[model samples]
Target: MAEFFNSISRRKFLLTAGASAGTVLLAGCLGNPPEDVGGNAAAPTTAQPVANISSEQAPETTAVKLGYVPIVEAAPLIIAKEKGFFAKYGMNDVELSKQASWGSARDNVEIGAAAGGIDGGQWQMPMAHLITEGVITKGNKPIPMYLLAQLITHGNGIAIADKWQGKGVDLKLSSALVSQVKADGKGGSRFKAAHTFPNVNQDFWMRYWLAAGGVDPDNDIDLLPVPSAQTVANMKTGTMDAFSTGDPWPYRIVKDKVGYMAALTADIWKNHPEEYLAIRADWVDKNPKATKAILKGIMEAQQWCDNFDNRQEMANILSQRQYFNIPVDILIDPLMGKYDMGNGRKIDDRTMAPLYWKDEKGSVSYPYKSHDLWFITESVRWGFLPQDYITNNAAKAKALIDKVNREDIWKEAATEAGIPAADIPTNTSRGVEEFFDGVKFDPEKPEEYLRSLKIKKANV
Candidate 1:
């Protein structure tokens, strides 16, 4: 038995904000985490004001509302707000709202298009790209979005129900398992494996995982969208047989004895880009100082989160009703580098942990253009973006990527935060990313990568 789960108590979600000028809480799933989870105990000392803007200078917009989903991946933003990083950079009144769903989260950004609703916070990087193209919008008015920082990498798992326990899906997916699953579905009902959203990292990675097991995600299994929080609950009710989502939820299923982690995404693709702090482009232009402050503060928070000592504290903060709202033990297990894979296999792996700053060069937070290119490629593969973007009109595609891939903002924030230059990537590309399948994504030759996939629209 995994001794860790025994120590945690089952709990319900509660939303309480601390009573202070800098801290405020709201009702339901996410208004703010408690004082500790909201901010660091000590604020970073090296947050230099942008353009000689002194510490006493006020933010361009004194009050800003940021939206985030209730998950551990949203930790950096919460930590920045809680730790006084927002206030430190002159954001006097920063409100962190826990969004109900991804579509709601995207709509809030569209609300920002009016110049007042939400300036920016953690969102799907693909949504950031698609929003710029008016793909998912309210008025077909494209909102240019910029990625300031990466929240976490490879911290999710694809969990399958207990019925499929020893069918060889844990850690590595099995073809036999896929065939069995497909055959088990009655009538015209499709075997479903829910991911958080379509045209996003979770969808792409989940597709790859399913495909690796010889399952055609589009045909053999219906890849549906389920809110992250509801994924485990639906799995419990057998609404979904499997789901690929951020940490704690996957672990939640295992704890309930309803599911087991079938494949660790980190093991499928190590140090891969996961989620990011994407600001609306116009917002970045108008509030350069405040924007830089947000990035710098969150960057420091990212480092704070990666530290081994802070895992339990992070779990505690997320456990409060205002955030993740799960038991502390379930939340902390993945953070502490332990995984109960639900198939009676336990593995201690750091690579599978939420990767933050891995030195300057290995920093997971840097908004690499190649990572965005991978997003575009995968998106286009699934017919999310135009096929021409991957072929004859690749430059137009590059330009679109350049518009959203804000490497400059990241480097500036790092320098202001006193993170050494060595930690920053000199170039936007992170070279070729090798996956467990022996395939490599050459940032320079993305077209080659797009052509290599066995089951993509590009290939078709």
Candidate 2:
């Protein structure tokens, strides 16, 4: 189990400020900012009169509200608070608010209802698009959103009911399960899956998985947008024959023997991007230092959670009322790689969780520009973007995608935080993602990919 950091105390907050100021003064005396303060920047030789300023003079903001859902993946935010990591970074007064749903979470951040919000991986792209397209309204003006860091990856999976067992549905491997579903032709036995929202990771993965399995998701099955928390219950009542969702739901279904694992998303696409630390772009510009500090705190918390030894403890923490609010056992199953799919199937596989910090060449920091173009390709495939969107004006499309990359800001913050630039992954690679059936994804050739699909794109 993860060890929770000692909670922040008023004295510790004050002490942190004193320590920051002292380090700055020492750097001034040595004619350089401390290597720990600004890693790669040359030590500044000129000492300004402001060097003597007291710790109390440091900028302090209060009532900084953050919105998040009560899910296991949101552990970093909760840990940062419980561990006093935020306090170490100068955000002493922070409020972690539990949002009612993903829509409310997005609205809270869009309308400045909270300084930031935590949501599923799937929502990140749509949120970026909403901000860029001026679709998110805030005080009658468009609100720009920016991704600060990736919180986790591969925390979601697909669940199918136990009745499908005799019919030959197996989650362990991605064979021709969907093809058999189509051959069954049970009419009303139509497999139904649920997602929280459109254009999020769930939608993309579910769509990709179905497409990879040779089942036309749009035509072969009914796709429904249902709340993540309600997915298991809905499955139990036979409202859904199968669904793709995050940890607790899939774990709950399998534990209750309601469903069998059809496939794990991580196995579908390894190291896939998931949740992100998101904030309004305006807020980012207004408080660059504070934003950097927030990233630092969350980044550290994520590292703390990624340790295998901390899984049980982390699950316990998330199950609290302020967090996921579920039984620790339910939260730990998928987290610990134990799969119990009620109909006599138990497989232990390491499921992907949150991966916050990357250590490359001895330097550690967050992954930037990690959102792939496959999402855009999927958007085109699903008719969310016009067919000519990428081909007719590739540069314009690239620019639209690059607007959400935020590499510049991440680089600046990383530099300030002492992370070496060489430690970050600069190259973005895309190919046809291979499914168990041997099909590959090629982002560079979306047109070819689309042409190869057997199903017709839905009319938008």
Query: Which lDDT tens digits does candidate 2 get at residues 252-334?
Result: 78877777777777667766666666676766676766676666567667767767787765665556543454566776767
Candidate 1 local lDDT, 1-460, one digit each (tens): 1122111101111111111212124321223334444332222223323333466444577666787776668888777665556666666566787765666567678878355457677776677887787776655558788877788887788888776767666666676766676675544556788777666777787888876666778767777776666665687787887887777778878888888887788778877888888888878898887787777767777888888887766666666555655567777778877898867778897667887666323878888888888888877777666677777636767888888888897887788768888788898888898887778888787788877777776653
Query: What is the C-alpha local distance difference test score of candidate 1?
Result: 0.70
User: Considering only N, C-alpha and C atoms within 3 Å, which residue pairs clash in candidate 1?
Assistant: 14-321, 17-25, 38-82, 39-82, 39-83, 40-83, 170-262, 171-262, 360-423
**Cα lDDT, model 1, residue 285:** 91
